[model samples]
Target: MAVIRVIYKEYIPSENLNSIVDTIWIATNYGKEIESRILPDGYVDIVFDLDKQKHLNSGNEIRISGMMTKFKKVISRKNSETLGIRFKTGQFNAISNIPLSKIKNTTINASDLFFKLNNSFLDELVEKKHHWEKVQIINKFLLAEINWSDLTPNKLEHSVCQSIQLNYRELDLNKIAKNHYISLRQLERRFKATIGVTMKEYHSIIRFNKVKDCIAKNPNLSLLNTAFDNGYFDHAHLSKEIKKMSGVNPSEL
Candidate 1:
């Protein structure tokens, strides 16, 4: 098999920015174009195509990708450099008034959301020689946008989101609603508004990620054991879920 030559890196934010920003990441491929699958993780991102020769489908170098609800395939252009800022779940609302529901499973030009930044901003990023320099510029720009925005995370909605993420394996929606003193319907509505996916869908994404990680770390482990350990009913159930989310069976995953 031929090896794929790609340079990918991620920079996690400091404690002060951790709650809002998940990480800044970059990927480059200088050879033939490559393809990769992106699984949903219920987060929003701002992606910049650093190669002036290429652009997003919108014909812009900068774009905002909304919360993903399913798997999608993306291509890395030949001699491409792409950088993105992934926002934490439900936190992109703090930066822009654009509703998460409006952009679900879609990519739009960044200018539509970041009206505060000038059109020359993309060019400024391209002019930076080092990736770290580009990251610093983005960090400063986002901090300014966050400080000027008055919107705050919804209290109860944020709490429920946290609960689902932390206890994805044993999620009990009714119990969560009762503990938060809200009806199940109300909880579902709020979660959909904040996260751009249903509570169950987000839970599936979190659980699927955990399952994928478990398999990666312990490839020798049996499917039955993995299923039971991760709270799935059985091997068949786990296989079904993995297939549904990733378009591949557990063994293939």
Candidate 2:
């Protein structure tokens, strides 16, 4: 078998688009085919498979990848290039009002969701030969596609998401709902509609990311200590959750 190498890089969007877009990324696969595991990060992505011959049956190069609940595997075909636009959590609604719940844990053609991102625009994006060229085109396209005047996130849901970030280690759903003057059920319903995941699921993602960061930064930290410090019941609980979310144990992570 020939050696396989993949080049992956991420570019920050222009300052004006920072609120809605997380980063624009690209990947190029060379030689042999490779399989990559995508871990859930609670964000949505618009992917463009630049390989014309392997484009979807509909002949559209663009596809929408929804929020992932668990790890999923993707094949990077040899000698293929792909570009991805990752949207910030809860910010995807600015471009298209489609409810995230409709596409959660699934991948769908871009045309199925919104008509604004038409074929010509996608073709222009795909035709770019260099990474920087593609980035510039996408930045300009998103600026035209998103309407700032009418973009408004639900205040309650936004606050809840912010609170989750601030209190990631110890998320109290009941208290959060009470503070926001809504019932737990109502808060969860609104969060699912807006964020495409339950509050608890999002919280788990936040906590897992924190633990992963802590372990990465403090390599000497013991799993038992990390778990307690991050509010996990114990080492066993931490390992189970990590394995479930990332398909790896804490040590492997």
- Most accurate candidate by lDDT: 2
Error of 1 at 155 (Å): 3.2
lDDT of candidate 1 at residue 53, scale 0 to 100: 73
Give per-candidate clash totals.
Answer: 0, 0
What is the total number of backbone clashes in candidate 2? 0
lDDT of 1 by residue, 1-253 (tens): 5456889999876456777899999898867788888887778999888876764333667888888767788888788889899998888887776668778888888877686444478778878889888888888888778854475767887888889878887889999999999999988988888887888888888889899999999999999999998889999999998888777888787
For model 2, residues 1-253, the per-residue Cα lDDT tens digits are: 5888888999999888998899999998877778888988879999888765575455657889888877888888778888999998988898888888888888888977667566776678777888899999889888988888998867788789889988987889999999999999988888998898899889988888889899999989888999999999999999999999899888887
Question: Clashes in candidate 1: how many?
Answer: 0
C-alpha TM-score for every candidate: 0.90, 0.90
Q: Candidate 1, 44: how far from true, in Å?
A: 1.1
